[model samples]
Target: MTLDPKEPVLRVVPGPTDINANGHIFGGWVLSQMDIAAGIVASRRANGSVATVAIDTMEFLAPIHLRDVISVYAQVERVGRTSMGIRIEVVASRDRGREEVKVTSGLFTFVAIDADAKPRPVDAPE
Candidate 1:
């Protein structure tokens, strides 16, 4: 997938401890980052608490290196009565931002919740 040029919701660099035996950043680390980014967009759209209900699709396009700067971009793709779909994309900037690669992409579903932790209408005002 093409990396979007828009500003990312989050950016982070992985440390040595995040690397796997294969010398690449662990998949779980990037997955968590995607979840965090998606949650931010989901919560904003829901205007309150939100929880991840499903990951519709996830693709690991390339390996992430330790020195790479990871940027996570997320947007609300669809909205229902009580759930929304978030599209998340991750890019890695290597060699001090000279090289950018699309590392991961995912579609996550989140349910809007109320104080009681029950699903609520996504369009409900806060």
Candidate 2:
């Protein structure tokens, strides 16, 4: 799938410290970004706090360089009683946004939580 041009949930540029021995951005760094973006979407949909339950699927389509600006797009793809499936896509903008490349994609599951930190119905009134 192509990267959506709409507003991204998060955008960041990796630094030299985030690079790995391969001279590319660390995979874990991108994963963490994805998780953070997905959490934002999940929490918005749930109208409260949410916790990541699982990473259902993840794919690395391309490498990210330090000069690349990463844009993360996340949305709630599915909703259950107390859980939500978030779809996240990461695009790397290089050459000052002249080129956009799909670097990673992931599907994450999150559960809505109450003040007690226990799972709660996602549709419950806020």
TM-scores across all candidates?
0.94, 0.94
Per-residue C-alpha lDDT of model 1 across residues 1-126, encoded as one tens digit per residue: 323438898999999999999999999999999999999889988888899999999999999999999999998889999999999999999999999999999999999999888899999964
**Candidate 2 residue spans exceeding 4 A from truth:** 1-5
Query: Alpha carbon lDDT of residue 36, candidate 1?
Result: 93
Clashing residue pairs in candidate 1, if any? none
> Whole-model lDDT, candidate 1?
0.92
lDDT of each: 0.92, 0.92
Candidate 2: tens digits of C-alpha lDDT, residues 1-126 = 323437799999999999999999999999999999998888888888999999999999999999999999987789999999999999999999899999999999999999999999998854
